[model samples]
Target chain A: MQGMIWLLGFLIGASPDSVAQQIMWRVYNRPSFQDMHAQITMTLIDPNGTQRVRKMETWSKKDPKTGETKMLIKFMEPADLRGTAFLIYQHKDREDDMWFYLPALRKTKRLAASGKSGAFMGSDFSNYDIGGGEYEDWNYRLLREEDLDGIPCWVIEALPKSPDVEKKSGYSKEIRWVNKENDLVVRTDHYDRSEMLYKRTVVKDAVQIQGIWFERVIEATDLDSGHRTVMEFTDIRVNQGLPDDLFSIRALGR
Target chain B: MAISWLMVLLAYTHLGGYLRFESFVRVDSGYQIHKLATTLQLRTTLDQPGISGFSALNLIMDRRAPDPVIFRPIELYLTFHRGPVDLTLGKKILTWGAGVFVSPSDFVNPWDFSVLYSDLEEFREGIEVADFAYYRGNAFVELAFLPMFRPNTYPLPSLQIPVPAGPDTFVVFMDGTHPVLPEPTLKKGEGFLRVGGTWGPMDFRLLAFRGFDRDPDLQVRYVWLPGSNPQEHPPDTIHLRPEYRPVWMGAGTLTWIVGPWELHADVAYVRTEDTDGTLPTVKNPYVYGAFGFFRSFWNDQWSLGLDLLVKRIFAFGQTPEDPMGVNALLEEQARMLNFQYEETQPSLAFHLQGSDTRDLWRWSASGIYDLRAREGFLLATLSYAWADGVSLQVGGLFSGRKGRSPFSQMGRHLGQVGFLEARWSF
Candidate 1:
């Protein structure tokens, strides 16, 4: 059954434990990733009914096999937040180091590693959101077997690492559904403080194009607010040659 | 450090704008240089509060000379983002509230840039504000707190003189004339906590404080009150009185951001309580206040803004919340320094005296108008502030007695004053 397959994956990744390891490589490793850049739009509603809108641009590269990843994100609009970039890399042992280039000082400086959970563009997304987009950062344990949309899946109970793991994470633990046919995760149930499911996500339209399986559509819904974002990945071409300098602060203006 | 200022200058020139630089040096913490090098600042705003406007600058190269330096771990502060929750370290502003009409506290925390408001001398002062956040999603919150351990220096506007014979013994400024609050001290232990967040639309914030401060160099007042007293004030209240003004505050703010217009308001009720009763008011009552702001922007170059504030000190003692006067605690501390003074006690006549007793005070408005929209060719702001009141008693001790009413101390409690600043940075 589906449960059996999910259980197999969970038990396989259960605990590299106690010590530190690049769990991202084991849990959410994807191969042959091309240069990815997203133009993210963020909106904030204040108590006074004031709303602020911001445009964020992000660029990243994944080796797919070696798990080497590098990323750069910056603000595009808003005069106050015009030139800001966050540079991060893949690392083991201690957490990855980060540096921010501020336009005001017009310099790039090191931010303490402890500030990873700090806000990124003042959005709900955190440095953990930058955890190389790995699937294994969550503690996965087989919970049940089920079907999402139509594909059979294995339900796994997974908890995010810890506060040490990410800052401002909305969910403590997540219940995810991994496809039995393919080794990719297809759905997730995000829990709140009381350990109650507050968000549910469904990823569909999967196809192993060019030897790699990928989800085409992802819908994340908040149980309390009923606000949701349906992300659609288009032109997802993997293994496009990207230069190392593509993820540098120098590449910001370009 | 040199490169940072170069960029600002270049940015101002190449970008066709203006900039201002300031570096205030006086000894307060272990004979160290306060604002050593200079403050390369270029402030411009997008949206305005009440008439409130937005601005930013770089607090650059605050270095201490090697000869007799205590510590200068904080070198430079750079900002790249402007949003609800601002993230900063080293030297930056971790601010909260609309900073308009009503705010809980304006103590420039340990974090270099914690309190970034007109009421503050330098947000990049006091305890280094570790980090600050303001979340207004469905849930909202704003908080700023930092390490409270540093060299100790009392707020001595009067004691501007360097200790005649201290270590490495040197005196640059004979008279204290330092800004506000004490320098820094490790014995103070951990700093107080100031946490504020909102749920839905109700604004909320809280503050934990230790030291104190006097009135901001500048404040707002109604130029014309209906009938109270002409000699009294310019029409504002809640003077940042000199006092051991310690407390924890909680409050909330509401804002409406429309395409290019921003209308925001905030209200707070804070309890002024500290670990020690070293301040004038021991059993100080809670204070309430509110603020309103309105701003408009045209494209990315032209804009205008407005801001207003009002606070109320309900009970007795030197109500720190008497937003009309000044920080009483700092005045006593200033005695150690050498500063100018006026000898006269406040009159409780209420009718003639521009000041009130120990109860009820308010701070009217805070703002700056945008003169330049694109590149700062020219910018100007017309602001007026005045505090009208008379102390029927000098916070009680000076109540019945006219001469013994701490007349020397009453040297403070000036009726009211105003200021105007026109800056050309490039």
Candidate 2:
């Protein structure tokens, strides 16, 4: 009876902040997948309703030891941009490394760490959003529980833990609505350095494939410019064993 | 002739090609020039266990006023891949080194100056070669054997300024002779080796090449003949000869990423046969280097690039003295050659490009400044996409120069050209 009482007391004493952190980590981390491949179509839409579309193929793999992820994206459509590629290596606790290849120049260029705040291929989505957010650099707080589009979600506010991260991110804080069912972030509102709402991201469709939940349709809108980017993933394959050589720099030009 | 050959090749291959057509009209100095061009690109691939095969062919038809219907093959290559080794044969275009406006290591393929307004990559003319590439981990080694030497083409004489002749001199033109090109043989072939890899956040390459210069040096021989009055009239018989000399080039390049920008540099040392620089008709050894910075801003909608290049001749002020009474024509020719070989030249180029979020409209401006000559060329264009695979562009080319610089000379002849081009790709 004494041991049971001790266990109940410990459970009751757990702070809400600690519980939110755990839930946020679980929501961002997801199930461990060896590799994934997908064909993604990005459509940029202006406030006037004009749109431009681009297509690309993406391959990603996770390192089991370091929990680092390597991704390769190669453009397929638009003759002018054909053969353009980007390779990214995301570390768990350090800045990500990225390289861009221009086929016309036949050279691969390393990109700066500050590229995380830049747009991804002229789209509304920031490089950080496409590379996966820097989750560990921010402090999360559980604001409330809410229902978004008939799905239960945990509304969490994330603030940069340090000034360096805040400056590098071009964002001061962000509010995310994470789906409780799959621990997938479904919506986010990003606030810029001036503490003004700058952009909003909404995940429209998500499906479970082989026990892994994947975001299928995502839209990012720039609040200031009224520009929107819609990304749709098709032919997605998860948990496929990929060769390490595919992530090498030599493969970028090829 | 090129179309017939392409037809034969296509008849044998199961895979087909894509066709594209483009048209443009330029109005310069009240002169209207119209152009219609067609291109067909063919590609095929085969994949099997431990082996793969791929080939590409590009055929073009360029038609303009007062010129014949020219048919040419831009690229034709066959590639084989096995494991980490890849081999390619036939006519192919390859680009080496890392520079946006200037690349000292891009010596294999010659540029097609006929398409000067197009992108640099589009100006490449393929040459027959055997290329081999080996990849290991993050590093790569490439070797190319070029069996033939192809020189860059220049505009028609009517479109270019002739060698200036003084008012007091009368010139007699002689038949121009072609350069003695290197024979297409194993011994006379050219080759290059490149080894490149990435280290941490930087990428580097070391390269060496043995080849002939793409541009030829003009050797003008003249004889002065006695006129009816020797003091009043000076008449000369002039002969222009083009010569191509051998060169050995060693180059290195490095690329580093700083905050919000990419920094790259390339240096090449060219050792020519004219070591002592005494040959009035041969090019001297020189060192060329370029530094560039590139960055994209405003959510990648705007891109800005700047490149600076320097070329220094090893032996300056070492040309053979001209004989007395060589006439003013010879003096002018020597002066031009001296300007090219004896001086250290520095040039700067910058490009700015911006596009709308939808990418339907784009504006770009680029300029090249020859600091040594104090001359520059500027180009600006605005393009709008009307539909899929179709676009319209309007652009203007201008030059600013005060002296007898290359840009100044060109501006005197061509002035400024305004062009409207419509393109369709399918």
RMSD of each: 21.4, 5.4
lDDT of 2 by residue, A1-254 (tens): 32243245448985546656777778777785789999999988889898878899989999998888999998876655666898988877655678878865656767766646667767888767876766677898878779999988878899999997786677899999988778889999999989999899999899888888889999999999898999999999887798888897766765
Q: For residues B84-194, what per-residue lDDT tens digits would candidate 2 score against the true structure?
A: 887888876677666766577766678664555654546776688898999887789999898888776542121122343455444444233455566767898899999
Question: Which portions of model 2 miss their true places by more than 4 Å?
Answer: A1-14, A45-51, A92-95, A105-107, A113-115, A221-228, B1-28, B34-63, B156-177, B219-238, B322-342, B400-414
Interface RMSD of each: 20.0, 3.3
Question: What TM-score does the A-chain of candidate 2 achieve?
Answer: 0.91
Distance from true position, residue A237, model 2, in Å?
2.0
Give the per-residue lDDT digits (tens) of candidate 1, residues A1-254: 43453345457774422111222223365554466655655543333434445556767786556556677777655533466677766655334545466654334433334433333333333344435234544555555567777777656676776663333354577676767676576777767656787767676566677777766665555566554544445545545665665564334322
Q: Give per-residue lDDT, candidate 2, residue B26.
A: 49
TM-score of chain B of each: 0.38, 0.80
DockQ of each: 0.01, 0.39
In Å, residue A119's CA in model 1 sits off its true spot by 6.0
Tens digits of lDDT, candidate 1, B118-230: 12324233245445444343132334344453322333232222222212222222223433343456544334454543332233345554433322121112233457563
Top-scoring candidate (lDDT)? 2
Fnat for each model: 0.00, 0.41
